[model samples]
Target: MRCEAAPSATSPPAEPAAVFTQFVVKLYSRCNFGCPDCYVYEHRDRGWAAQPLVMSPAVMRRLSGRIAEHLRSHRPERAQVILHGGEPLLAGPPVLERFARRLRADCQGLTTRVDLLVQTNASRLDRAFLETFRRYGITVGVSLDGTAESHDRRRPDRAGRGTHAEVARALTLLRAPRYRPLYGGLLCVVDLEADPVETYEALLAHEPPAVDLLLPHATWHFPPPRPPDGGEAPYGRWLAALFDRWFDAPRRETALRLFDSLLDLYLGGTSTSEMWGPYGSDVVVIQPSGLIEYNDVLKTVSAEAARSALHIGAHNFDRAAADPGFAAERAGLAGLCAQCRSCPVVDICGGGLRAHRHSPDNGFDNPSCYCADLSFLIGHVRERLTHGVSMLRARFVQGRWSA
Candidate 1:
């Protein structure tokens, strides 16, 4: 199951290997529900419009073998493999079942702990599909942007119909005791208009294991909606309201990514330390064609830029990891922010998510689009910090410290 190509004799002695921690595999390049804000088609550099709808069997087989080999060699403590795509569910049950079966068999040696997850829209959930997911212990995170009005505004179908009803109904079914464990939680994009309190309550009713709020994909060119100059905070205000409500909650398990990041930063840790930071661990994305890319969101930055000449069948994980071009892309991220070099919190924030720094002129050599938002949130947290230790203790005890 393991293969380690000998390091070339001419090359200097190998440095310690960076452990491979997480990987995203694209099962298909097609989706059933075409959300307006989707990065794959709406904003991507590479076109998925003409690509194969599903991953070929050959690629899947090779992928399984390679991953198994990696597991055996690296003995990664916990390897997370997410089934991602334009719409991963587009590949029917039979296909996914075979893929998962092969993956299990391939990862034979080394007690390699694995975390399997699927991010889906929930519109395609069915008994058979549910069975496959449950069987593999796949944690399903459904994309539903809060209330119907809020969700329908941007997450509409190609025909412009609202998908909220289908998504809500699906959640209701998934939350039933028989399938509740499979209901991972809801993932919503921050829609400025929706009342954060209402959105929080509505999603909380389903009682998911967590909730994730994401800033809509945007850049200076196609900036996400913001309040006009001199107007009140747009995304900041909305998130602030949610933070208040969450802080006031009596009991909660619905984790919020933003709140968690802010909390970590406030507690003298890097925000997004678990996910987006530089020391935040490495993530590799595999497209259906077996092309390896970084921060899949970069797919939206340009069509041609997304096509890396890498394939799972032709390349081993070690070779791909040693790719000079790939290493350069990773290195280029740190230099993107002159501000980060001088900022004390760069280690924690990683200049915001890598994809967010992308721009036409400098590539991924810019700060986050949400820089202002982060500043606002950090200021709020710092103000609270300056108060007496007694006040901080009181707030924590009162549960009024949620991000």
Candidate 2:
């Protein structure tokens, strides 16, 4: 049975057509940590090695101009500029401040809201860096894999030393009364081997406002690790266990983005993140050298999968929107495979992340490697929600009859 290509019952209101709303600017091309699972460093893409170590003043100026032009042309109600890296902090406070100030000045009076954010490994976040972030109103999102043992296993420093202590210290600072407002949240890549409940407990220790659990970037060509003894859907079971723990907690301490998205979908609401739903792609990335590209996760698919002829030095946002890769992402569900079109949860999963469906044999015309897991998790959430609603309805009737 083929599912029709219609908006989900929970789909959000349509957004205005815009060239792009999120600009991910790569401030530096080198990272301080050597995370084994980093799509940029450990994946097939080696393009980063050839780029300039840091974004130059001239390139930043050009980027600012291009972004301002894009905003003025499209006039999206709001926009966000994300400072990404090899470690955005590696660019130092002075450089980052200049970039932020330039972008804000250029877009002044154009965008209704301008948000600034920095995604960091958090090891280098000290008092000085926090002050700079505060001055610019840039929220800090830290990447830490659960507990020390689980985190240090994959994320290490250049000298091969465990960075858990440094990350922990940074987390402490981020959660401090003064800096807590700047703490955006925690982003943890799932380590299948780690115990889900223990990992959840460890992450909650820092009291992050939210947590985003990400599936490690993988494609059909280089798939994620399989379960032992050919067991089916290990990742699905793992996520489900974590969902139960989060749902059953006496009080919801922190927002788990994945579970929250799933629950929202099941309850007839659209997803807010690119990881799910039928939201059109509204993000564009700028390399340190001024090249325009799709999402960085495309690096995991192939070395050149993310490479585009569009260069911010020459092309404006309109030219980038014309790029075939960008067009494909903008196409949304129309770009999904037939298998996805036939799936019952097509509205919820949105054919998974585009990069995860890649293969040498069929390009991206395939469902994600995590398809089974997504289906299982979504179904589990829907069932639980349906049962809960039924129970509430029954109690309401019983109370009326007794009265």
Give Cα-based local distance difference scores for all models.
0.73, 0.87
Candidate 2 residue 2 Cα shift, in angstroms, is 35
Model 2: which ten-residue window has the lowest total lDDT? 1-10
- The list of candidate 1 runs beyond 4 A from truth reads 1-14, 229-233, 268-276, 328-333, 385-389, 392-403
Q: Where's the lowest-lDDT run of ten residues in candidate 1?
A: 272-281
Q: TM-score, each model?
A: 0.87, 0.93
Regions more than 4 Å wrong, model 2: 1-18
What is residue 20's positional error in candidate 2, in angstroms? 1.0
lDDT of 2 by residue, 1-403 (tens): 1123555889875554447888999999999998888999999999999999999999999999999988887776778899998999998999999998898888888845778999999888999999988888999999989999999987999888899999999999888899899999999988888999999999999899999999989999899987676367777778888888998889988998888887787678877667788665878999999999988889998999888988888898877886788888877788998989888878998988998899999999999999888888877777777787999999999999999
The clash count of every prediction, one per candidate, is 6, 0
What is the alpha-carbon lDDT of model 1 when measured against the actual structure? Answer: 0.73
The residue pairs in collision within model 2 are none
